[model samples]
Target chain A: MTENPNVPVLCATGVSAIVAGDAGDFRVLDGVSLEVDAGEIVDITGSSGCGKTTLLRALARLLPGAVGTLSLRGVSAHDLTPQAWRAAVALLPQKPTMVAGTVRENLLLPWTLKVRAQQSAPEDAVLRAALDGLHLSDVSLERDTDRLSVGQQARIALLRILMTNPSVLMLDEPDANLDDASAAQVTQATSQFASAGGAVIRVRHQRTDALASRRFSMCGGQLTETTS
Target chain B: MSGAGGVIVIGWWQLALATGLMVLTGALSVALKLGVAKQLAIATARTYAQLLLLGLVLGWIFGLDSPWAVLGVLVIMTGVAALTIARRAPDAPAGTTGISFLAMLLVGTFITFVVTGLIVRVEPWYLPRYVIPIAGMVLGNSMNGIALALERTFSDMDARSGEILALTALGATPWEAAAPSIRRAMRAAMIPGINTLSAAGIVFIPGMMAGQLLAGADPMAAAPYQIVVMVMVATADITGSTLAVMLTYRRRFGADDIYLERGYRPDSRS
Candidate 1:
């Protein structure tokens, strides 16, 4: 079924989160709301601990204390199973976590999940080609993931989530550990994803958001759209 | 009772004479400035007191010869076993005590009955001499297994939060995400049972079999009893660990299928 261009591919309303701090419980995201339509690349910028990552996590339903009304393609997140909702709207955390295995296995991790079991893994040649597109031709698929540099691991983790073909991709600091060149490559890949009718919401510390059509600034647990 | 094959009963004086060895050990520990001296002395004291109390209780229960008496003692033993596990795994979720109690009570009672009623075919299924000892052995072994599994499951989930949450983000179910840790816990729980089974007759004679032989029972009869016990303990360990871990591992996750970081509540661990 074709998606209505008028309807947002992903939407969140009054997304609030209360996280346990070292001192005690504190509000992280307070009534933060946002919407992203297909082919839109949204950028969320904030100071450290400004609830940027927390908001992304809340949207993905990863935070247990988060309260919000989230919808995907006009369908309520409550209507779908969490597994189904997460598969449709995937999150790539800030830290890159690679399981113990060859790079090929790590890249194919999504398909190995039971929720994604119905989808077959792509061919190694296809994966190798995707790596080449991401300017990671030096990284071999047979190489152990632990041996990869953090930058390489970050890119591979991003590619791994993209392999799931999620409609809305939430990235937390995708370029936190990448060099300028590697960071550019990430931006290019995400731009291509957005242009292909997929939605992208990225958390960035830097002000450069060349691909974003809409920019948001989060402060004191609130999200406000900035006039870019 | 002094015949070559007959049982040898130690008098009270002889039992006191045996206490001298433990006293000597405690003294040696103190002389060597070992910090374990106090623990050693306390353990020795507990061993004597506990065994004598057990003998008194068993003597009374055997005299009563009532099925309700046997069941009551077994239930009390199961409760103690559950409490021991709950104490050992303090980091476990809130309902851990209830879960462990249920698991031990069900598996322990089932295994004990199977041994006394069906395997040995004791004349009276609830005969204290048969039922109490069998229930004790089952509950003791199962308590250790379930405790190990419970401790391992929670610790593993905490340590592997990164990998688990990553899997959940890709839509893995809670079971699928926690499967590795559960398997590891189950394996760790089974190791002692496996070792006991393998070393029973070769490395050392098991307690029940050794007691039987010392009491002048036939070696053939003691061997079958020991075999039954080894098999029973292993079976109980498997079932108890599986039940305890299955019932409790989900405590690490929320109802929305998200893994609660460090269990109980969602924190900023990641």
Candidate 2:
């Protein structure tokens, strides 16, 4: 629980999910609790289908049936609109699909959401700054997204989330598609986000240099903090 | 126009010719072992019986001067049409039946009323002959469009659930997140109506025009009525699909903007 508003950017307690199946129902996660604070990176590792993604989804407010006491920025998720809450705790999926557009259109797609309709589109300077932070300074908005490599697409997806300036970033194996150089750039960018007082929660496939301050293992829908 | 009042009526012998042709086709199918001979005969029998019953019901309603009877018949027809459309969807659509019914009734009644009340200007607006026939035409056409639209909408959104979640994650409303699929559904539903509009005269004469021509109406007069009916049909199609999409897309996301674990798909999206 957020003992202080300045401490944890996001917290989930006793989070559980039961998905209905044809034969019967199955519980994916049970009583999993965690806290993510600004300027901190929490690394989660688990086997596929071990409820790692489910936990991230529950934290992102993307799973409606998930049961939990989850809060973002000390505000109960129930109190915030789904859109606003999701914006505050953005979840980046493993393989993100790119829309049909130039790199600029893909980058600015988040601004077109009705939740952001009231706010003006980010200025070109902001877009450039986001790209520059991700070591994509040479990339231009005019370039077609289709022309970009998988690594570039991964970087762009990261940049897209960073542009929103989400308080907590829940990344699900974001490096699975990234090359060595691209992975390095991503790690640097995430570290920068953490240093700038943003919370980073990531489920890593390989324990590369991700700069996580704490490590946790997810098994059978349960999370245990490890002091490795 | 002297003999146009009665024109030329089809006697029983000439009508029997069509029956004979159908029998011949059935025999040929039977001989060729197409396996559709029984189906053909059953369908023909069902169609004949249904139309005969409908004719009798219309005769009774037309004899009555009460608007209630006409409106009641229209309401029943709309319900039947909605059910038919819902059943026609590829997926198990018990959930969407009510929405489909609302969509069909709203669009079907609105356009049928506009045509019968304003444009055609029938003396008694709810007269059975005018109201029922217009409702039948509008409802039937829009029903197919709506079924396709609903099926497409459900399947598309279910398939694109990930994309939708991404948009939601980026602060997109359910409407914004599901816009592409909704657009696809609308276009899929409307394409047939639009094709009818595009192909009405050039490809071949449509049913309304054919009926008017057979009833001794002027060709030029029939043409204008055909245009009006097509436009009304298109309106019904567009309105029904749009309403269905608008109502159903919200179900993909929960009250708190979270993506549901299972949507319209029988097979889970997990």
Candidate 3:
């Protein structure tokens, strides 16, 4: 496998995962396959425990029990280091997490990672603009994240992942804790991301999002494309 | 019953008097319904048996004065100490015993050698009378430090799962993600030794100093020896804890550096 723009930005084939449960080890994802091209948004909707999150984790290489082929820009996942793979394919978990720091420090967390050490951090103006785009203009960067509401923290987490410039973004309910207005802003932000030649794959419990170029529904650990 | 160096040895009748103290303690526990009378009796018995066995073994080993015998005894002491450390930490992963053994063995031997060879400057340096006791002390102190540090590292990593996952998702290496937890663990492990150092002499006479005094060593000589013992123990504790943390923190992550969401399990040592 080699890097090529014409190839799908992210691809997975026959990915399966077995998560340990109280009862026993059980399959959460079974032989799921997907291909995502640049500048497209793919929405995955499913009931709770139906494996939407499992599929994203498998793609992100966060689940060691997950097995199958995963590749980015035609390069097999094995070709890239785990750090390199994760840097390019980032997975935002369901619950938003903020380190002990001010908003600016949280926003710059990705830059502090060793994988991103070589790259210069974004300027304060750039960060302010991004925060503004997310309807956080009223919040000061110096404000401690612990004081921020869960909704605001969620938005900051989304922006933090965006700052890393991942090629493919996998979000697990990015707008779960947000108000309608903030939720719309999150949609708009993702839309803007896809418009900039990035691919997005997100799990949503609500109806199919209009912004999604393709929609898929999962049931009983299997995924099927649905006509939108 | 007399020990070397003008030591005032306790007679069997005197030991019987100490046994009476334990019996009184057991009676008090029974009266208070503390449910510890049986355990106290067993522990008292074990204490007498173990100490007597230790005294006998040391007497024989001290007389041999062979370097191999001293080394063998030290290695065995380290092995037992490591096993105890591993068992003491309920949350540590399975291979913890092996790692603890290695950390204590290496750190204990190195510190003991430096203390005897350079500091105390024992001629031949393998005299069991000097080497065995010093090595035993080093292993004992380092064992405690490694256990505390390993336990803290595992528990802290488990508690800070969200932070760890966030960092790992953002492309941090396992070490990078665990550095904070390791720092806290190292601090937690080192605190006891630091406290001992600070409280030495003022709070209470330490075990080695008291032992020397009981054995009738000169107060001036015992003071310097106790100082060396305290400093060397602190050094061994810090170094052993560091090595153990460094070796074990990576176990919190899996193949491909995935944050083991379940954290580590004793059954899954690999």
- TM-score: which candidate is best? 1
Screening candidate 3 with a backbone cut-off below 3 angstroms (N, C-alpha, C), the clashing residue pairs are none
Better of 1 and 2 by DockQ: 1
TM-score of each: 0.96, 0.90, 0.95
Off by over 4 Å in 2: A1-5, A21-23, A123-140, B1-4, B23-35, B90-94, B261-270
Candidate 2 chain B, run of 10 with poorest lDDT: B261-270
TM-score for the second chain in candidate 3? 0.95
In order of the candidates, what TM-score does chain B achieve? 0.94, 0.90, 0.95
TM-scores for chain A, candidates in order? 0.96, 0.92, 0.96
Worst 10 residues of 3 chain A by lDDT: A17-26
Tens-digit per-residue lDDT, A1-228, candidate 2: 233557478889999988665556678798999988888899999888788888888888777577889887677878888788888889998887677788889888988887777777788888888887777878888889888888888899889988788899989898897778788888888898899989999998774663988999999789999854
DockQ of each: 0.67, 0.57, 0.63
Sort the predicted structures by TM-score, highest score first: 1, 3, 2
Best by DockQ: 1
What is the interface RMSD, in angstroms, for predicted model 3?
2.3
Put down candidate 1 lDDT per residue, A1-228, tens digits, no spaces: 246667899999999977766677778898988999899999999999888988887888888878989999988988989999999999999999998899999999888878877788999999999999999999999999979999999999999998778999999999988899999999999998988889999998963867899999999899888965
